[model samples]
Target: AQSVTQLDSQVPVFEEAPVELRCNYSSSVSVYLFWYVQYPNQGLQLLLKYLSGSTLVKGINGFEAEFNKSQTSFHLRKPSVHISDTAEYFCAVHYSGTYKYIFGTGTRLKVLA
Candidate 1:
């Protein structure tokens, strides 16, 4: 079984500030990690993914994450964010060779202008 836990449900920040959204997961077998961003009334866009090799993964919109096996964590980070960054972010895991995915409820990022 695979499960994901997002540490925060909402993160509010002023424009041009850095932010980190924490995520943790547990799985019996190996899995793929993914971060998706969803704007209001829009579908999810792939932010980044950690599959197989490499511990650090970078994604669109100046986002990045480091996969830590020991801690079972994959936290998203941005050096500086803009008001446009406000959206819902989700952490998800997919079992190897399986279509089923486990997703964290979501963490809403509100970047105030």
Candidate 2:
């Protein structure tokens, strides 16, 4: 079984400030990590993914994360956050052959202007 954990339930930041959203996962088999963002009343949008390759991965809107094998973590970060970045972010783990993605509870990012 695969599972994901989002350490923070909510994070508040001022506009143009930097932010980080922590995520961790556990799986018996190899897995793919993904970060998705859900805007208010909107569907989830894929922000980034870690399938294979370099440990450090970059995503849209200046977001980036590093895959730590030893720690089993993939934490998302942005150099500068905007009000538009305010949303519910979810971390997901897709275990190979399972065809299922286990999602975290989600972290709500509130950007104050």
Candidate 3:
């Protein structure tokens, strides 16, 4: 059971305001998509990926996502958000002859500067 599900653990905005962080995945085969950002102690930072062909994917500070294969879902967006984009966002999955990495128990983006 390869899985990744992040349906908001926390999201409090104020600074520039505008956010959406929700992801869902359950893989049996093809998978390789990641969105990671953890600021407050720093480590993970690879803001976007969808691996295959385009289904609307963009990365880095601005952020963007839309890979919905019949609602398997991969949702993340940032319109107007700053405060250095207060961090802690993880949604990862890797399949297809694995190196094994499945996450998504985090989504704490509190940007209120």
The TM-score values for the models, in the order shown, are 0.94, 0.95, 0.33
Give each model's whole-structure lDDT. Answer: 0.92, 0.92, 0.87
lDDT, candidate 2, at 101: 88
Model 2 CA lDDT for position 64? 97
Model 3 agreement with the true structure over 1-113: per-residue lDDT tens digits: 77889988999988877898998998465787788998888799898999899998989888898888778778999899988888899998887798978888989999888
lDDT of 2: 0.92
Name the regions of candidate 3 deviating beyond 4 angstroms: 1-14, 17-31, 36-51, 55-77, 82-87, 104-108
* Per-residue alpha-carbon lDDT of candidate 1 for residues 43-96, written as tens digits (9 for 90 to 100): 989999999788999999899999998888999999999989999999998877
Task: Mark the regions of model 2 whose C-alpha exceeds 4 Å error after superposition.
Answer: none
Q: Backbone collision count in every prediction?
A: 0, 0, 0
- Among all windows of 10 consecutive residues in model 2, the one with the lowest summed lDDT is 24-33
**Which candidate, 2 or 3, would have the higher lDDT against the true structure?**
2
| lDDT of model 2 at position 95 | 83
- Per-residue lDDT tens digits for candidate 2, residues 32-101, read 9999999989999999999999989999989999999889999999989998999999999998888888
Name the TM-score of candidate 2. 0.95
Clashing pairs in 1: none
* Poorly placed runs, candidate 1 (over 4 Å): none
